[model samples]
Target: MTNLAKRIIEFVQRPGYMPMKPKTLAKKLGITKKKLAKFEAALEEAKLSGEIRFSEGGRIQPKAARGSHLGIVHRIKSGDAFIILREPKPVGLTDDIFVDRNDLKDAQNGDEVFVKLLQRRRSRGQRCGYVVEVVERATNVFVGTYLEEDESGWVQIDGKDYPDPIWVGDPGAKGVQEGDKVVIEMLRFPTVGQNGEGVLTKVLGSRGEPGVDTQMIIHEFGIPDEFPDDVLNEARLEAENFNENDLTDREDLSEMTVVTIDPKTARDFDDAISLKKIEKGHWLLGVHIADVSHFVQPGTQLDREAETRGTSVYLPTKVIPMLPEIISNGLASLQEGRTRFTMSAFIEFSAEGIPIETRFSRSAIKVTQRFAYEEVMPIIKAKPSEPIEGVSDEIRELLKNMHELAMLLRKRRFAKGSLELDMPEVRLSLDTDGKVTGAFEAEHDESHEIIEEFMLAANIAVAVRLNDEGIGFLRRAHADPAEAKLKAFSEFVTILGFELEKYQSKKHLQALLRSVRGTPQEQAVNYAMLRSLKQAEYSPMEVGHYALAEDQYCHFTSPIRRYPDLHIHRLVSSLVCDNVTYRGASAEDLIRLGHHCSTTERRAERAERELTKIKLLTYFEERVGEKITAVITGVERFGFFCRGVEIPAEGLVHISNIPASESYEFDRQAMALVGRRTGDMIRLGDKVIVEIASVDVDRRELNFKLLTHTASKPPAKKGAAKKSPSRGKKGSKKPNSKQSKPRKKKPSTRKKKSAQKRRKKR
Candidate 1:
């Protein structure tokens, strides 16, 4: 491979070099016939490693040194970005290469770029780079806010992730006004001091219009909001024709008291649970998942579509499904009192939640009831002695048993080092007009835990089964975090009251989380801990999940919304039913599929998060200048961000807003912005009163002003030595040097000691 690499480098350097295929390159290099294959493999590896590059003419050439690195640009904050390099670079240069505002070169979030990495200066701790080229745009289209200043027409992109108002000249702005959101096509990118120019492709409605904000996000993310004609036709046919033969060789569980527990507004109930106390000390807990694979067979249009979508995207008030509504909402959904095909996992547990055994099989089940989490929460919380009126004794007993078992499962899980950070969730209540009437916190109750515990158990059991047989399958893997991140997290927790010596171990991470469970700082610590752990991805390798503290875990529920679960169903079906064999996807194919699905899953999450921000921005637009109490979520050199105690969105508070009487300094070790003059610290988890200063819909952001005024220090006497605020060695905010205060003198320690001795003698 080294020889091949050297040969290719020499070949690309030749005069009049043109890109050519590996076959042609091999022939040009005069390799022997038997060694041609090895040469081609090396050529591919060189391309992947960025030692060689492909040009537009389908030809290969030597890569330009440091001029091109495969990377993705993340517009993480206002007017700033960080490019994550995908292709390997020289040793010691980390993948997280920074890009300043001017260096972005018209790149947006999620865009794949080729960066020109600048020289690293030891003066700056982090390496900052610039984008010389865009290898691929995340999307050519954008939802823009049209602006017409006295007929000088332009469109500003309204992507929530972007903070800058990207103005593009559209000769065809088509008379769109300030409030109208339009779709644009970039014709030319910006250079130096100008905005990019584009062509108006579409014209959405005015901002804050019913359904306009949601549609904007859907368009910005390029979500496939509607099914194609062929896909819809196929889905409708499958929904109309329910073949009796499909249920052949499947067990019928209609007699069981099966019920689905989901949110009140949930449209697709993809999972259901049934519980029965069959023995003196044991209970059979059944988890039934919607059998999507049964309807969307491989090699069909529906299967192809589902694979392409990977997973369904749920916005605040909308949904883009992986499967068509005819299947995901009608046929494949586990509707109450309707017989639907399913794959079931039955686990026998003692009075405790310890699983004695698990059984898997294909089944045709009719759900007896559909209860929302709100309805079930009251039942679960009811005492056995005081059964709720209008609730059946059978249902009450079932709820009680499930809650008990879920508690046991949760206890066992945390005992084994699971990371449980009970972070709050935001739920918005929309009126019939699709407007956000109210926003509130919808917290997790025991009912939610009951379902989560059961689903997790079934998923782990299935993962263990497939992996034990040595079958190649997609496993949810969470790799160990890097050492640098662990060290940083350790330093952070040490300042927040933890012993940092043993923080490197996962057990220490677990212990730290457990120690702060009931404290006021638990949520902030949990958010930090969550940031420290690695993200879970679907892979063909059994790498294990770190957050769950499980060696085996896979997505085995919610097949209606997720593709991996549907694929798992097909694989597990072969083991349970006769005449069924797992030929859905090969191990090699599964590898590719896993990567694609994981990418789509991330895309879906981003869309959902963006929607929440957009909704909050719109909702709070009317409430600007209203004062609210918030917790300090994060602190930096420039400012700190706050999340409202009862609100869902987070906003920033610039350090300049701290009263002029006191100069604020950001302390990296303490994760706080301290008032140097008064010794008042605005640290993580600290409460502060703030007023909504402004809201920018284009950025989907809120800027807050501190309402907690700082008290000024008393005046100093004449001709006394002055005192100044001290600063840290790293990443510290520069303090105000012009302001000073006189120091007060203290009595001598020896004189005070002699006075104390005299008092003692008396």
Candidate 2:
């Protein structure tokens, strides 16, 4: 069920809150017209089910709230599961409530199950919970591989776990063969001795097929892979009629020579730059973004589809675009030599890149040139005797000047306490056949920096203007770090030989990052700094960006790829163009839209990251048995995670695989593992030799075995207890073992003393 529908159901069953009208509830819950169908369906379902009643004046009232935890079930291969609770959870409950194997009942992954919270057993030292009832089955469709075993057809659900093969009971096994990846609708869930019975519905493809991994991710994430016919028809008609009225009365900048600099593989040119020299030590800069709102009018079929997708999903093998290709890649894209409608931010700046005055306008512009970052980097850096082919020195000089101003702007931002994080982005190269050829880190240079500074300037300027007008809209907000987390992080950096107070300030943290830029510890320090900051999200509130140190910030570029940028474009057009006004979203509507867009952004990021990891793991499948020296980036009681400087992956060396000489104890505060007898220690910033043991693509983990040389015989295998997997300090690994007992934290002396003192004072 949709999140909005679930919320409506919960509200209907909530006590103390009176029944509300459908229209009133939609407005109060911040639901848009696009989602009214879902809201109404949920209301009808609840009333028929007797969970709610239709009172006088057509209001929804609850009978009584159910006594269970409502959450999505995510199951593991060993049947251990975790429920990620939806909002309005029980008071004082952690977000994740664990349900063991036996407690899972017939629950599957992605089910919204109502569970009962049970007390933790003192002897077992574990918190136990079970699925009291399945409130809603998230999906009956299963994606799996069809297999033939023991003269019977079976479908092994991909990424799902069972103790034995799931037999496909002969009645539902038609039209599917062995080795095919197929989607099936389950007729019955599995029981003690019987496997889940399913009817084969649609065939995806054969196992290990090209582009199958990307498709699998799309299915798993519930990403809409294809545009509906109605949406496609609207997009086509909109593109076909773009240049009619768009060219009239808009500021005609077709005479200006604008350039679009992007990656070599980028097809959609959403933003471009135009520079004009006003006089010596002064320049007029134009950042023109494609006017997506002009084509995707609100409440249209195209708008609803785009809003549902929220953002484009870019995988290693393919891209699931937010808008139809005809729009995102055609008229809406500011391609070179094409006159396209745009929303331009004209900012006059001095030599220092400080804006003298900022203005926004609706314009028509023609991009004169498109330069890849690799080609423009040299011209910007102005290396000695670097020759430019087929380009005039005037263009080269413009790029040089742009880079100069961008540097000034970057320096200004850094001086104002902006955090420059060094996070690496890995992109996979695919051949014509869609096979993973290799993986490489994406390169960034002055070309990228220039665009970034220009975009930030425009965004900040627009946000300032909107706030001055007292306009309530979605703005990016990043609150300061929590005091408790700050204290913990302050203690962490002291091990790296810096004063705890130094790490607290953004400027000092930037300096610390600079100091470790090229050192072996750079990644570790970067990770810690990243963890110390709050995540930036969209909100209607005017909270400033803590990391950028900006009082006002919003995404104003790349409207084709992001929804908030489109909203900003609409607002800008309204304020600039006399005929238009931004009146579609209320303050409450903006708040809800902001939260939803932020969630969609994170979902897209996670999908992209997982695809990259899958591709990168495939790249290392060729070297599974190779022994490589790695830097220990994290440690735990189970094992140490060593990052491969040369390889683009981190693998864990489980504790059981360690040389059988002495037992290892984990020091939580120290973040290290110490040998009890040998006095040998494996800690962060250390090196170790490890041989790659296995790679599980479904789990997206790379496992390694320790190769420490010791003069002792290896332990025998007879009746050895199964060891739980060791994880790196980052808490990224998941093991298939039984649920672990929670460890009791060591009592702090200071806390005990403070408690005693409080009692005496009372």
Tell me, by TM-score, which candidate is best: 1
Local accuracy of candidate 2 as per-residue lDDT tens digits, 129-238: 78876555655666677788677777777653544556566633546667777777777788555677777777677756787767767765677889999999999898
For model 1, the superposed segments whose C-alpha errors exceed 4 Å read: 1-68, 75-81, 87-90, 98-108, 115-122, 125-133, 149-152, 159-175, 244-246, 278-280, 350-352, 381-390, 498-501, 578-581, 709-762
**lDDT (Cα) of model 2:** 0.74
| C-alpha RMSD of each candidate structure in angstroms | 9.4, 10.1
lDDT of 1 by residue, 128-156 (tens): 78887665566778787777654456776
| Model 1 pairs in collision | 19-59, 19-60, 20-59
Candidate with top lDDT is 1
Candidate lDDT (C-alpha), each: 0.76, 0.74
